[model samples]
Target: MTKKDDIVQGEGTKSGGLSRRGFLGATALAGIGGATGLGSLVMTRESFAAAAEEARNNYVVHPGELDEYYGFWSGGHSGEVRVMGVPSMRELMRIPVFNVDSATGWGITNESKDVLGHDNTFLNGDAHHPHVSMTDGRYDGKYLFINDKANTRVARIRLDIMKCDKITTVPNVQAIHGLRLQKVPKTNYVFCNAEYVIPHPNEGSDMENMENHFTMFNAIDAETMEVAFQVIVDGNLDNTDADYTGRYACSTCYNSEKALDLAGTMRNDRDWAVVFHIERIEKAVKDGSYKTIGDSKVPVLDGRKGSDFTRYIPVPKNPHGLNTSPDGKYFMAAGKLSPTVTIIAIDKLDDLFAGNLNEERDVVVGEPELGLGPLHTTFDGRGNAYTTLFIDSQVAKWNIEDAIRHYNGEQVDYLRQKLDVHYQPGHNHASLTESRDADGKWLVVLSKFSKDRFLPVGPLHPENDQLIDISGEEMKLVHDGPTFAEPHDCILVRRDQIQTKKIYERDDPFFASAREQAEKDGITLEADNKVIRDGNKVRVYMTSIAPQFMLTEFKVKQGDEVTVYVTNLDTIEDVTHGFCMVNHGVSMEISPQQTASVTFTADKPGVHWYYCNWFCHALHMEMVGRMLVEKA
Candidate 1:
């Protein structure tokens, strides 16, 4: 096995022979094989800072230190949500959501265009699956949500000022992809997953009737971001999961031959994994039995084929990640073109939704082949199960009840260690592996092509993530990093379950509509500075503190409609402050006791310069301010 480990385990199969499906079509064109021993399993040099200070699964922080976990990434297509820190992966904060941020003027603030939708009018976004927001199944540091597979939308954020407060737009879905929440009574649902299959009145009258194209399974309203019912199901939802007695949830439904291309979605060798049954889709949405399509008033129901709240099951090739298993007993399902990982048995999903199981693959109970391209799975609360594979760039680590005692034939080996990851890994997460407190330390992976690992930065390649340690019994690779844009997925949380907030408490329902329009124009954003014109519409009102900006100058006029607002007044929690109006692309961010707004329209008359882009102290470029404008 050492001809560069047979070209990194596959030049279309050799080492152990037989992989079939033409070795996944030679692992979908597996080229780029480099293996410089994945840089000796990431030990950078000099005993890699003494094996990261004798490993406690620490990634080392220093400089006023702090970071025991908080990750929450997704930022894919950079629609934004970053916030890292776990085992020192650093990155700290991004949030923006559905694009347009320029330092913090998220979509150029008017309180983020009243939460990105006074007609969101698209600024570009993609952000896939971020999560966080759970309760009895853990992590509840308030909210996180995410997912905007480029505008099928679903924002949320607000885990105590991490920002993004609410976006919604899930009407009948189109590519909301897969999102998850509701792990028991507390989360009250967020679900999601619409991934293509249009024409339900998508207006174009079923062009050639692609099986009347479908897609739906939404469910928002984890505190009113609305749309609380959708279901529809049958295939074409990608990755989603939930289980901990909130009556189930789970997705993975590859093209199920709704066929549109890519060889008619691999013409099924089995493609399913639905599940659903959240109290019978909430008693078929409180007995209205469900319908309403175009002009979505939510309630869709009909969990496809024999629905009474779905079951589907099938699964093999084409199923792509639908995890679960954190001692809530199993739901695995990877198998993107098969290497296997079915698993199933969450107490046999109440005996396969009570039709007394016996097939629906008998609520699955383990399939296990695990290799080649098993797409995604994670969990470690001791019964293992890492699984990333993606055409064998590796991360297997098996063992769920010894792969159900080797699928019940009991010769039990369950393949444990695979490691390698550097090229094409698509999602692998561990710490708190999907709730029930799954603390198996750390394990990130992500990959999806980082070409030569780092420092080429040209043909667009910066996604290597890595970071392992999986708390012993082997799986080391501790930290490789790189990441940018294609963040696609990430979640760790446990900086004592993230309780954040050292400032911004004053009237904060996140700037409570800019403190209810500065209490209807009498303006007292804590000692307001004042401007307030109101005809061509002005309203200035500044404040700050570090290195000034309590007005300093503010005029308006030329085609008015200004706005401004500011208000940091430094309560000293990292004294934040930033306003940037220069050449008017208008910026924002005023943290401390916070209050922000932005408007922008003096339509360019003169003396713009507003400054203070967040630095905060020692005359930080003299914080500055000017805005004048008058000349209409």
Candidate 2:
């Protein structure tokens, strides 16, 4: 191999030494080469210049300006959801879902504990995917759902207040990894995939039986946060996606061999992308054609090998992510072990389900070779696809129509530009790619290993979330954001698509219970500053206007159970208040025009003071209240 070929292959190669740079060079290059030259040669120096200049204008969000797109990222090990501004890559907010945050008093507050169950639940979560709600293939922005791969749970956050309102644990399933929302008609269902296989009941009765071990495909009611049904499919599930028509939802099933060993799981030459008939499954649930398994009352349907509710399409080795194209034409299943992506036509799926198509391969329209370890695929509305080549550490940009033409035995070159990433990249998403209006303006590359990308902060390094301007013909990497731990997956939507309220509503359902408590005790939360004693419990009803609390002092007996409720009556925006009791492990947010409460035992209390932690007015430091704990 030549020096150029050596440099390319030294990185990685697949399907007979086929490197994207070398392939593009041998196909389109006479002499021009390298990153800059390849850009100019492909799109011509003049057009490339215009595209490059426009890309520079995409990222620079000046002071007092808002971003054009909102990015919802899954905080992998941290067990939270992070919202960042697209193009700018600036972290806007962190919505604590399954994780414990002492700063915002997420786990300490009674309001938060109501959402997070008070039972034997641990404060840990491994969030994998975050998908926004949709309406008829468009972002409705009502809610955002995220899956906890660590704890078999899913949590939904309200878009208006940007707080987690509900969290539901998926019974009879472990490791809820892949997650997606419905598309057409509305996102009525939130689909979650069970990654690990465990025997039902897990009572050690069938300890060594591999056949009894299987995972499930779960569909959750988006509004109720309840498990609607579970479909038992073949093998372990990895990633999943829904179609625009809302008739089908497909998941990539690895370990089709159903073996306990790692080598046995990868023994198959090809795995299956199991597609579920949503309408038929709904019918089965309605007709009571399912059975309850273990302690979970969730209706479980057998969609394994020969079930009519699901059809297993044989795909290349170890299929990973199942992504539907924006135009609703094809479903691209990335080959995690192989170097190609199998494109299955969505229109032919109806024929396969109707038994008109004899073979499962009849649904496959194209199997174009992209690069080594093609894990996930995203689309640009202009009939092009950008796939994350994991082993190759590159993003392959290819025309979808050209790939279909090339897969049809044409000699056309479907390979476009392949840009090198920092390290191993995983899931990459384009702007509005999940909705009908996939404008394809920007792309976010989530690189798993950020080696040498940022300053080394000890052994554990941050992930590299790179932003690319896909508005032009060539994809240009604009910014590199050093993210916390790992952000597994993310989705981008237009900023205008999401409508957030500046201040919390007084009648918001998030704190409706707290409001009801004040009404039960004949206390006006908006103006009352009353303290009532009931047995060994003290109810401190307080209000905050701006710089001072309405109840400046309240006396309670030591060793008494105290429930302090603080209501912020400020009607202005950005006047969020926080109640933090000194040395009491208590802190909670009370947004403007909102009421929040926290419960704690006054065991070792002397004269503990509570203050507003969030900055508000000039006398913010004066916003303190004393809790005088008398000797019991």
Give each model's whole-structure lDDT.
Answer: 0.79, 0.86
TM-score of decoy 2: 0.93
Give a tens-digit lDDT track for model 1, residues 470-577: 787657676788888688689898888878789888867877998898899878988979888878998888887888887888787799888888888788888788
Candidate 2 clash pair list: none
Clashing pairs in 1: 318-337
Model 2, span 207-241: residue lDDT tens: 67888898999999998888999999889898998
Cα RMSD, each candidate: 19.1, 4.1
CA lDDT for candidate 2: 0.86
Ten residues in a row with the worst lDDT in model 1? 28-37
Best by TM-score: 2
